[model samples]
Target: MLSHLPTNHHLRPLYRLLALASGVYVLVFGIIGVVQTSGAETFDRSGDATALGLPTNPAFAYASVAVGALIVLSALIGRNLDFYVYSVVGLVFQIVGMLALAFLGTDVNYFNFSVATCVVSLVIGLALFTAGLYSRVGARADAH
Candidate 1:
């Protein structure tokens, strides 16, 4: 189904850079969240901890750090590995954002996500998806 997708796109470098920046942002945010919520329980849902203007708890913070690191590594090792990673991760983020939005004010909001976080997640997801779609590498004959 994706056979028509472009390869060796002119904007591939820009897309890759965007993905890298998103990874760094998530990583830094998670680190700050971990520090800010150090006193709280690992999965505590009662605290009002925040990082980079996004609501977070220890669990979410740690998860973010791991995900961010993965993205960073994938971007660094780009070759098509990044395309797959970014695509999958982007979809996951999009799902997470929607789920977070659905459970915004309820007890199921384990991530402590605010509207801003949801918005940012969606944006980042789209960015990553775009990068994945166009950042592919292949032989010159494959560019057709």
Candidate 2:
């Protein structure tokens, strides 16, 4: 998948910027998650206002931190769409989890899953998804 990354593209900078921005966003949010609610009686699934969805708390917070780390790491190593898959995976998870949180709700924990939470997740999912897909470098016209 990393066989051929475009040498140049107008959107490359924007792509990298988005990647970095999103990466930092999640990274910081995830850190806050673990630090803020580590020993709380219940989970805390709220934050990431930058679309941000910056979700967090306890076991879930650790999960976010891991995912956030991957996102940040990918921005460093993911020079192309192939590496951007990490971002895609993380965003998709947020989208799915938030959607479920919005509708079905979690019985496993009493986290406050509200409509706003769903919106945040969905927004972040779309944002990262867009960035990942947009960054894809296609085969060159002369690569045939």
Those runs of model 1 whose alpha carbons end farther than 4 Å from true positions after fitting are none
lDDT of 1 at 118: 96
Clashing pairs in 1: none
How many clashes would you count in candidate 2?
3
lDDT of 2 by residue, 12-104 (tens): 668767766766766676677667675654454443322235344465556657767777777777546424664566478566756567454
Summarize candidate 1's per-residue lDDT along 27-107 as a digit string, tens digits: 999999999999898777765888988788999999999999999999999989999999999999999989999998998
Residue 66 lDDT in model 2?
77
Where is model 2 poorest over a 10-residue stretch in terms of lDDT?
47-56
Off by over 4 Å in 2: 1-8, 41-56, 81-83, 101-112, 138-144
Q: Looking at candidate 2, what is the lDDT of residue 116?
A: 59
Top candidate by TM-score:
1
